[model samples]
Target: MNIIKFSAQFPVEKSCIEHFKAQRDACGVVCPKWGCVHPYWLQNKLCYECKQCHHRQSLRSGTVLENSKLPFMYWYAAMHLLTSTKKSYSAAELQRQLGHKRYQPIWEMVCKLRDVMGKRYNLYQLTDEVELDNAFIATLIAEEEKDKPLKRGIGSQRQPKAVVVNESSFVENPKPGKKPKRVNHLKMLVIEDLRADTISKTVNEHVNPKAELTTNDATPYSKLFEQVKSHHAQAIKKEDLPKTLPWVNIAIGNVKRLLLDVHHQLTNEYLQYYLNEFCYKFNRRYFGDA
Candidate 1:
């Protein structure tokens, strides 16, 4: 939603709390300890009481906001800004906007949200035709490597290997200036190495076994056929990437630019969280301001 709509909908902290409570209620609160789906809302305590074990859990007990002391409005506002924009706000920028005094809490909150984004996307597998490729995203050198001699060129800095896959469906009818395929869902996974087994494992987990796959004739993708029904691996030139593996290439380029533009220095530990936010927004691009 737009700023005006958001402001009108959640003008006060109570409104945000009520909306969150309604959403939690619709989803049904489960007792994390006992896995009890039914829970009674204790008005006085503002928590859910499990009838089965007489356990009381706060509203945010099992959610991303479990230990967060931030106001409900802050979270609602953050969600709105993150979803409503084409790009994302850095934790520092978000903290400035939220008027928060400390940086750690806001950063943690953003990272937690991004982590959940990855988890939510993990529930679904990509189907039909997909293009797979690997990207080396620049990252901050490890503590041990910080004092070591730097290598030349790309190797001078630490770059994390990421497996990028996107579902692309062929469009029978050609629109003027449009590509032959349209992208659906996309996934990016950071891996230790770009070995055949590593790439294969990522594909098997995220892509449906029945889906047809396409990739450049990279040696690491040699065993991709074992994971999917069809594997089309061909040598692709730089100019022909638009026709060969359009969406995956575009996604890789866009994400790299996004990270470079927003968070200049990245750590290997949190690289996946950054990727998760990009993929989450890309997947929901059609749902503008939702």
Candidate 2:
């Protein structure tokens, strides 16, 4: 929903809390101690009481909001802004929008949301035709690497490596000046290295075993054939990348632009969180205002 609709729906903190409670009820509240699905709502305490074991849990228990002291309105507003836009907001921008005096809490809240988004996407694996590629994004050096001499080029301390995977299929009866391949889901995973073992393990975990894979003949993807049903590795010329692996390259370029545009100085530690937010929004691009 847009800002107006969201404001109308949740005008006050109590409204947000009530809506959150309703959503949690729809998802079902399980007792943490006994693993019981049925729990009695303790209206006075704003918690759930186990029907059998008498265990009690707060509304935010077991959720990303657990241990967070921020108001429910803050989280609801953050989620709305994050999901409702094509790009993202930095923690400072979000803090200003919320009119909050603190920055770290808002930053942590956004990071936790992004973390859960990555975890949610992990539940599904890319299937059918898939494209794979590696991306090098500019990231701040780690604290421990401060003393080490920085290398130049792609291996520089400022650049971090990530694996980009896109689920795509051939588009039949394509329109003029349109992409030959259509994309479905996308994933960008931060990794330590681009070794063959690392690439193979990542593909094995995130992609279906029977999926058809396509990528440039990079040594890191040498063992991809063992992970998927078919690995069509080729030496892709610079211009041929669009035809060989269209969606993966496009995804990489778009994400790079996103980071460059909004988040200027990203750190290696939280690069994955930023990537998670990008992929989450891209995957749900069709779901308008949902």
List, residue by residue over 156-209, the lDDT tens digit for candidate 1: 558878899989999998798898999999999988887899888899899999
lDDT of 2 by residue, 172-239 (tens): 98899889999999999999888899999999999999999999998999899999999999999999
Candidate 2 regions exceeding 4 Å error are none
Report lDDT (CA) for all predictions.
0.90, 0.93
Clashes of each: 1, 0
Identify the candidate with maximal TM-score: 2
* TM-score against native, each model: 0.94, 0.96
Alpha-carbon lDDT of model 1: 0.90
Worst 10 residues of 2 by lDDT: 258-267
